[model samples]
Target chain A: MKKSFAILATTATLACVLANGTAQAGATLDAVKKKGFIQCGVSDGLPGFSYADDKGKFSGIDVDVCRAAAAALFGDAGKVKYTPLTAKERFTALQSGEIDVLSRNTTWTSTRDSALGLNFTGITYYDGQGFMVNKKLGVKSAKELDGATVCIQAGTTTELNLSDYFRANNMKYTPVTYDKSDESAKSLETGRCDVLTSDQSQLYAQRIKLATPDDFVVLPEVISKEPLGPAVRHGDDEWFDIVKWTLFAMVNTEEMGIDSKNVDEKLKSDNPDVKRLLGVEGDKGKDLGLPNDWVVQIVKQVGNYGEVFERNVGQGSPLKIERGLNALWSQGGLQYAPPVR
Target chain B: MADQQGGVAKPPFWNDPTIRSVAFQIIALCVVVGIGYYLFHNTQTNLQQRGIASGFGFLQNPAGFGIIQHLIPYNESDTYGRVFVVGLLNTLLVSVLGILLATFLGFVIGVARLSRNWLVAKLAMVYIEIFRNIPLLLQIFFWYFAVLRNVPSPRQSLELGDAVFLNIRGFYLPAPVFQPGFWVVPLTLLVGVIATVVVRRWAHRRQEMTGQPFHAFYAGLGLMLGLPLLAFALAGFPLAWDYPVLQGFNFQGGFVIIPELAALLFALSIYTAAFIAEIVRSGIQAVSHGQTEAAYSLGLKPGQTLRLVIIPQAMRVIIPPLTSQYLNLAKNSSLAAAIAYPDLVSIFAGTVLNQTGQAIEVIAMTMAVYLTVSLSISLLMNWYNRRAALMER
Candidate 1:
């Protein structure tokens, strides 16, 4: 009986191996063009990053990044399809070729970049971990939360940062974790936890979901640097360059004082830099295996970096987060782009 | 007898059934092993090419995440190896409690379904049908998200006398704080158990020899209860109960069972009991009516008929399927990931796997745990099944 059982187990294991044997490699660009749609991965429902409206239309800064990619490829921003993934599912989805570009609010860490077989293009949002607490707790600072219970989302850098901060300060805390951001926020609202911790941008996004958003305040302590960006699979360098340069063009357009409303007029400008960026005086787009008009399409359809950020997560939207660290290098921020020439 | 009969001396080795069977088995074994090696080789190459680590070294790294409920000592500074152990223990904790509760509830409801009273039987049937039809994941969500969320907060908790409190967070029960001289209580209990066993054996032999019944049940009960109480009085009751009190935003000074754990336990037991009830009911029904009638004809009471004749036979049919239900309950506890309960799947497979980016190693370890647990349960149940088998001449 034992021998037969061993035989059966061996056979089952062999069958599983055969079933999972297919490995996709290094043709994402061709595949995307053939399918005529970019398979983009986004967060499930993180407002200001990736969220859907009541009619099921996805709109966020990350969503606009995918739109820009779609416009660069097909001259149509609506040709991209979005697949909402949880924090735990995003990496595996990219590794298995289930999604072409992972534009979810994922942090770029050294370990992930080196070990996860993925390449992050550029920073889309500069965020840092922060804490939000109920005002009724009468806590002025995070140091007062020594013995508090905190609500945190699992499978994110925020969890690790919270642990490090508490341990460094010689404080003890109880963490009640949830699979989704909104669930953790709900737990906080229901008084199950005294504090909620996440990226400062996400704290604002989640706070708005509460019945009384005004009752809670984000603590004034930014704990860790979180450079959120879009990532792609590792084997295709051509696809990598396209995604990387697409982001740079957006930033460069913003640096040159270009917006969606003024893009048409700038196309006729005599300025050498504007002409080169608008793809009228250079072959930089052609060098990246795209048409010379690619940048024009992206700028016309998805707008510049400032326009997308403001409309989705800044002064034009409900989040109203300041562009403190996301402004261009000319404006004394870290967002500098190489010249288009 | 040494050779073959009624033919040429024995078929050649190639044509012999024994030789043919051996050859086929050898070929099959070789094929399976070859495929296994090929798969392993391919995985190694893929991992190297992708630059992902493919070893167990990550187990030594600090976990840096907190688990809400851990049976063993754990902190954020502990290693991933410790986290894995904590996760395994929590999984076993839920599975064991769920199995015990489900079995007890299953037996009661199964018997209630067979009751002669119309309302009792109908009620049991309704419960069985309702829970059995719904998906287990949906039930877990309903309990964790809907029911627990509606409970009152800690400051306004529903107090159960002065010993227990219930709220949105969970139940807080008074915990016993043992003093230095508390060893005498367990010692006395052990002595009482040994005395009961000796008395029961003596009574059994006495009844067998002289056909005079002995009251072993009452005598055993007295020793078990009276000895403990007497020991407690002699030892000055070296224990104190610490009740939970509202402190700031939550309760303190007692054993608090978190809402996640409670919701998971409640959902698992209730869902598993429905299927176990069906197994138990069918097992009892499988026993023939003739056995009960024969016991009745021998002037046996209804209780004696059930204890002596009906139950032993019913257990033979019940134990096999009942083992499967227990295994199912244990595996279903993995669904605790959906509700963020920090079971083995949530902490190790979900969080740890994401952090390390080592999918192959993490998943293999997780699968190995489940496989080992299942095999152990099967081995134990099979032993009991063999002992309970009917002997024949």
Candidate 2:
């Protein structure tokens, strides 16, 4: 009787394992395609990058990328589910398949690329660590901040860079660390620290929170290069390629003078690169295992990269960050996408 | 007839009815182990497929970050292991301080709740209810945002004499600076503690033999204080304090308790104290009214009755829940992440997790640290409770 019971339990376990193993692994992609939506991870509440509105509607430059991806796949930019993630939970959420893509102004680093099973498709925002001090402090440059108390957000690259910059310059400073960006900025304003340091964009966002915007001035020192970008999980190569090509296509479309407003008319152009991009000449879509008019759908539905950038973070927006490093490669920027062919 | 010998007839090992139960237990254990192994294997495969490493080697790498509040000296060049230690020490510091403050305030409020003064009782009740009902996270935010942020800057800091200053930057006060021979202080403290222990043993033996009270408290006080002072004097007065000086926009020389630590401590203490107040109130109330009346009837004054009779008996009921409150305070210190206090959770779990991208390792380390702290506190409390109970018996 005991022997039979042992045999039965072993059989049951084996059957369960077999059943799970036999299930199709492409269920995630299938569900995404069927629902015609992409669940994207975004910042919980960082202004100028990703933030929820008064009604809790998520919007930002990061949000635009996810929308663009959905538009490239399903021909509708509105078909995106935004999942708000904190700094700690963002990578895990993507790896766990909780979100299809992460466009949360996350920095691209070697560890994340190799150790977190993440693929950073492209750099969206070029930022750097900077400092903001009260104008009344009479501090013109960060070099003058010897023994100054600095309010820094803990668990960020800024903390590391801040230390490196201070140490390299032979300056002494005390850090008052806080977990959240808002708290650190608040502490600095309240005189808990002499200065607040973070990404240059974040510095601008946080400075406005001061009692008077003119009270604080961001020091003109770019401490460290912060190449922020969008990422997807590593296991799904096909999905990774799709997200990567979608971003590249947008930038390429903009560089080739193709845009949402004129994509339909541009299809008749004689320019070979433009024609191929518009699905007039080659099997670019077939090679990528996508529809023949992938770029067309992306441009028409999500607009070109220039449009997305201008609408979210460029001159048309409050942040108004210059497209210096985010400009096309031909325009003396780092944003170079591979050819479609 | 055979059943009558031992109330039952047991068969041989293989054929016994209980054998099936043993077999079932073994099978269940195997199944659980198998499932656990299978899941682990799947996770390993998944991680391997994505080229992600699963290990703890990252702990020894250069941390590349500087810590704000460290008990031990740390630098950006230090390994991540050192940073972990720094974070662990900070967490322990807050937990210890919070426990001390919470217990003190909790006892006061708890005693106040049982006071005859109507106004005092109602005020204690109001405080307990208000703090106990609201979330600790909300309280942390309220203190960090509404209270601490509203303080004036260092240049115009609200000064308390020349020794202490209250500013939004933090509490700037005199830090006890040790001179070259400062090691003598800790040595003195150790000698004092040893002397106190020796005297206590002697007093206990004397009491056992003579059946008389040996004034153990007075004896302990004299030995501990006298020995420490004598050592300090003999050791050439090894310590001096460096008072905080306001220099332009910042305080220099002396230690400044950062606002993050202050806010975290304040929030944790107040929140934990409320629960402790309830525990204290219930503990005191559980002591019979007859006991209080008997003390009064014995010509004891109100304060004396509380100190000598009521509080000691109340402690018997108060200690167990009070232990839990202390543990809660320690665990809640992890919420220091919300305010960026550089606690173990924030530094190790938040920052290290991001830097290394080893979520499982970082989280496991964090959980293990908290677990060890919580367990040690509870274990120590249990020993104290046992001793207290033994004395009562």
Candidate 3:
């Protein structure tokens, strides 16, 4: 016990030195560059958002966000290591500098941004709390969910949303919460619960993995706005700007009809807007502390935002979630990015 | 030769053993305390520098999640403080229940292990070896997953006399609802309890002073039961049991024991009882064989010899280690978080800490609660040990 305490004290002391004793500006980026990689935190196993395959390789939009950031910084997408964290452990991992960027499907909330010493870079996926019920139950909607036994995943916004929806409708229900989503799904499959509540995309993702996927149906109700994003620690504005703009750069490339396939050809085009963005007429990466070809490396390596989505959660993936709220602003969606130039 | 003969003279203060020992202790204490203070201050400064809020104010904010089981009233809009209370109560409920069940089962197995019957002893031995060797978490998973398998879903519940129901969701029994003037029944019951105690004492006095035996057992039992029955008759049977009815998706209006609680209770008691059985067996064996022989020579029955002579003496050896086992059971009850029992560690340290981002404060409070609980158990066992101590004087 004494030895563990001594070790803990030494660690805390080292953490203090790293947090305050080092050169006060751009420390995270400097450390990342020195360490030769960026430590990125993602979900433990959220399907299509960071779940690992049988080969232990992680794929999803969240993982791509980190790869895009890494490619922009080091020009090598592989120069990033993944740390999968649970919902409860994600914020602390980011705040403690255990990971440089928390690209997990974490919702951007006011309390988390202001109080937890975290600054959300930008929303990567717009999600909402939804329910998945067995088809045999014949429950039509969330309103008809009165007196239902709802299985919810702990440490997420779904639990709170379920409670609120039930209370608002003057209904009573039992919430059987579990730490892992798989456990909740198992309970639902066994008829232990009448409803399984989670983000809509997650419901679809979990549905396909069920023993009989056709038995479950995702409800149409979208209860709460969960703008999932990547977050950086509070002190490093330079690092924060890099992380934020990496995502915006991807979205802007999508809006401008550029992708990994046509990026080299687009460099030869005469469009002034594209020229300034691609560092042909103007260098857009200097202020953000990057090289002139950072955007080019990102596009070449990670593709545009739409491609990431389609490859991970869109038609190319098993989830096949539509980009309803995630399309570009020109397409009358919520995904609007500021002009690059 | 003269100095050796006169060596009993008082030594100088600096060279004295007492003074030197005291000095070393003071130095050691200062170093320990200084390290503790440095660690605490360093944590506060680091937390502040990192801009994470560091205070107990978050506990007053609303806890926006729901718990599956709460012994008291709870709502989603309640404060985090209420959440802590709910989690603490659930933890205590599980720990206390587990301890009681483990003690009972442990004593039974422990005594049976020493039985002359070969099959019974071997059965007890097998049970100990099987349960003690397996990990408690896996056992919990096994019980929770495989439990209620034969029981159908809520739509096809197994009913008991049209008042109780058992299904996949839980086991539900009729909940007792008291109507107007129900207090009269309880008040009469309490009166009967007091009367039974007084009658037992008087009977004991008569047996001792007049050399005549009284059937205080039957008299006490009669007063305890007959008075309650009489009160119910006079008060027009003011108690009613509300039966559980099948509702939209589950049963409603019943006292339901959720599967999580049942699975947790089974795992905790069965696992802890294995260790406790060994402790109890050793305790009973520690008592000399001569005591049993002497009791038998004095014309005592085998049952009396075991309970009156063996158990009383065995308690002295049992209690100290028994306290440790009880503490283990209580601390291990935190594993309830695994299967969603809404215990203190999960609800308070997990969900509350996540929502508020007060890891340090939440952890400190959780550790303090466990320490308080363990210490309370230790103190209680110590008191009992003192009473059961041998009176050598």
Candidate 4:
């Protein structure tokens, strides 16, 4: 009997190993529920993307993604505890299970998705690497900025991109990397470095925080594709589905013209797509192990993708970034979500 | 036989001190092993469950990053293994510079504290009290942000005959573009240095055997300097200066010292020198005053008294504590990460770990490097300590 039981256990383990994606299916979800909150990893400070005020309140597009995930699980956006991480510390924090979802402004890369054992749910923000220079330097183009000292944030894709760009262009540069965005910006402001390079959106976000934002100009050169997204650890398919669908639900609702302020009104709509997205007609959340009103909860709490974007990083906010590539597919943008049903 | 009285008895097995102690050690050993095994097993299981990659395999992967300071040549396409070496070299470079500067400054301030002039001793006292009390990172910020950041931009660089320039970007000095046969200078210098050491040793032996004095300092200095000068003339001046020139955004084709390196070096040396100065002072004071007086009464001048009697005895007290200061300075060099100095902790443990996501392996490797550096320092200092220890025939 003991031998038979051991054999059964070994076969079960083998099955789990074979079906790698289903390994520890509901482990994170159960742990998160038992702890009564989602552990959301975010950036320490990047104004429109993720920043915490002195009151310890976090507000950004990344924070809203975490909030949507929390609302889907616990029906309350407040059921999340934020752990602000530096760029270097974000992935390790997620892998160690110190946080359930890394909603920081982490770029989606092939190496990160495959080798690092992370699954990027979706791209929440589309960005590109760019350069920002002090206007006094008269650096009109990146090509003319060769042999310059550039302050960059450490542990970022921008560093590699900068290196590749310079090497490809046959130009020489000195990269002085900093741990925080503000520090890099400050270096540029203080004349210690000739330019600051980061994602163009981040360059704008960092620009407004400077003492004289108007004195700096972002060079008109988009160097690399940066699809900033949220990521979760590999395995735990059930948890992965829930976090992933949370963002997609927002996108789907936005496509159906449902938002946080109009979510209740939309729940009473007779349109099939709207009803399905609001979780009124279809049990959209059943397979993901969430309640039927999961979509409703998310839409009511964190708003749809366009609403969150506008409020945080888009025209409604200080960053004034246009919803170009991040807009809906029908509007000639890249944010296209699958049908709810 | 008489001492072996019948009334005397051996303790019971439980009460046997040796047996009890051995059993206790065995139990403690099991506990330690059990804890270590549990942690290792737990980590293995967790990593497998998360599908996170583990092991030293990532070191072979491309580092995919550029560093500002690479002591050896480096490229972005270099493997993580090379990044580790580059980072280790930078850390060693800064630590060596800081150690040399701190030792010199510390020795000067230490002796000055014992000067007959009241103002000199008080000023040294103030310096030690102020610098050692503050933190090292703050001083690094002060140097990088407050001081170096205020330097003029490259367009408005302060230049010395256009060969050297000071700018916000960095301190640019003319790089030596070595032509054919420039290696002779360094070769001659090396040979002169070795010859000087041999001559000094011979001079000391002769003085001990026949009480005949030799001016070894003047002779050795002349040999060391004169040989290098002669080699330069014979080599036909096989060196050219690649002076920095104003380019588009910055000076080009020159040797540069980025402010990050300068700030970290200054902060580390100044901060550690304060502690080392106090140690030197205490070590000197630990020697008896009678040693100096005895040398003076034996017809020794003040310089000879210090060189022959006081310093040798003081070194015995100084070496042990000075070893700790050296270790502290080396370990404290990790704070260069705060200001982007491309030290071991920043490049390998910071960017490399982030890129690879192999936290356990990368961190363990970094910690191992620091441990090896500290252990080697302790071993060298202890050897020197033993040599300076008192000996009797």
* Candidate chain B TM-scores, in order: 0.93, 0.88, 0.93, 0.95
Per-residue CA lDDT of candidate 2, range B309-373, in tens?
88888888988988999989999999988877888888888888877778788888889988999
Question: How high is the TM-score of chain A in each model?
Answer: 0.92, 0.89, 0.91, 0.92
lDDT of 2 by residue, A1-341 (tens): 66876776777667657656732234355668887799999876777678788998877778878877787777678899999887767877887778989998777888778888889988888888899988888999988998888888655678788889999999888777665677677677667778899889888877655677788899998988998989987767778888889889988998998988999899889999998998899989878767879899888977888888887778877767788888888998787888898
lDDT of each: 0.88, 0.83, 0.88, 0.89
Tens digit of per-residue lDDT, candidate 4, span B1-393:
667786679789999999799667655654565456556666777777777788888888887778887878998899999999999999999999999999999989998888889999999999999999998889999999899988998888998997999988889999999899988899999999999999999999999999999999998998899999899998798899998888877788889998999999999999999988998899889989999888989999998988889989999899899999999999999998889899999988999999988888899999999999999999999999989999886
Rank order (by DockQ, best first): 2, 3, 4, 1
Which model, 3 or 4, shows the larger lDDT?
Answer: 4
Off by over 4 Å in 1: A1-24, B1-27
Candidate 3 deviant stretches above 4 angstroms? A1-26, A280-283, B1-26, B199-215
Q: What C-alpha lDDT, on a 0 to 100 scale, does residue A80 get in candidate 4? A: 91
Show pairs that collide, candidate 3: none
Error of 3 at B194 (Å): 3.3
> In model 1, what lDDT does residue B384 have?
93
Query: What 10-residue stretch in candidate 2 chain B is worst by lDDT?
Result: B384-393
Give per-residue CA lDDT, model 1, range B97-146, as digits (tens). Answer: 99999999998898889999999999999999999999999999899988
- Taking all chains together, each candidate's TM-score versus the true structure is 0.92, 0.91, 0.92, 0.93
**Candidate 2 vs candidate 3, TM-score winner:** 3
Please give the TM-score of chain B in predicted model 3. Answer: 0.93
